[model samples]
Target: MNFKELHNQKTPLLLGNVWDVPSAKTAEKLGFQAIGTSSSAIAALLGYQDGEQMGFSELIYFVKQIVTNTNLPLSVDLESGYSRDPIIIAEHIKELVALGVVGINIEDSIVKDERILLNGEKFASTLIDVINVLSKENIDVFINVRTDTFLLKHSDVIEETKKRIKLYENAGANGIFTPCIENESDIREIVNCTSLPINVMCMPNLPDFNTLSSLGVQRISMGNFLFDTMYSQLERITKDIIDQRSFQSIF
Candidate 1:
């Protein structure tokens, strides 16, 4: 099935999030249905801070490498589109589409030293403009709109998410990604409110796969958790090697 169809399956699509070629290869090797780039992880690997601090050209180059190396349907986490201008964002997305990207996760948040939620109504307007531009250019790609209400710890995440998802749905979003939302009831509330596929990210408190599936989630993402865990293990092992003062661990 295509990337968009994957979101509609009875079993929620489990997306392996990768930052580089090896990670992408490993996900494909292990049989992940699809994979997505974690923009923050990619930025860190390139020695840049998260958000859109990494240049668009740099992102295109890195994403092209993954696209070239992997066969699995690939989605890119395009944080805030790297620009507020809808035209420029659409153009950036076009670059990804040309690189064979099947879908993308674009969030409604910006980074000014830290991530902050954007005005929902305005972001929806931005989405409309983006959709219009893409349609005019005949560019088709799954646009998963990420709302940061839960991510930012909004006072009322469930209600705020419902409000934003409706706006996004009307704006032609293909999916809704609510990161950092873990409570089963909250997940059910959001899922029940939106016709668009509801995507939930991996969090420490997140429910198990079956529970998420039962709650009506359509997509489950790892965000940067896998990359974070792998590297955290690497750091620990390297530290252990130093403490032991031997290369025994290498074998």
Candidate 2:
């Protein structure tokens, strides 16, 4: 099934976000329907900070590797498309489409020295331009528009999120992602306000899969949680080896 059909399934589409070929293969082997890249995880692997610190070429090369190694439809977390100019962003996306990527997540936050979100209307306009370009090129990539209202804890988050979702949907967004939103009531409100499928990132405080599905969440992404957990395990194993002077942890 295509990524769009996966999102429209009765059960929520659970994405295991991966950083490399091995991780992508593992996710597929374990029966995930699709593979999504975690930009933070990829940035760490490339020895750079997230938020576009990793070069676009480096990111694309890494994505090419994953796509080459796996048959699952891949969606990339292209943080702000790596540029503000819509044309440049569309060029990056077009290259990804050529590389066999099926979808992407683009956020509205500006992640420079300080993390400031773009104005809702302006971001919507940017989405419109990018979508127009993709359409003109006959690319069928899913555009998941991410708004960081809850993640950034913006004031009047619910209302602001509703406004942004409305504008983004009108701009041709395929899905709406609002990460860090754990409250059931708020999720229900947002889901009710928009016809576009809702995607939520995994958080400790978030409800379980059944509850989220009932709340109208069509997609659930692990984001960097899997990568972060893997590294934490590595740290623990290294400390164990140092303390006991043994390689038993590896075994």
lDDT (C-alpha, whole model) for all candidates: 0.92, 0.94
lDDT per residue as tens, model 1, 129-237 = 9999999989989999999999899998778889999999999999999999999989998999978899999999999999999999999999888878888988988
> lDDT tens string, model 2, 72-177?
9999999998999999999999999999999999999977797789999998999999999989989999999999999999999999999999999999999999
Error of 1 at 11 (Å): 0.4
State the lDDT at 74 in candidate 1.
91
Error of 2 at 120 (Å): 1.0
TM-score for each prediction? 0.98, 0.98
Stretches off by above 4 angstroms in model 2 are: none
lDDT of 2 at 96: 96
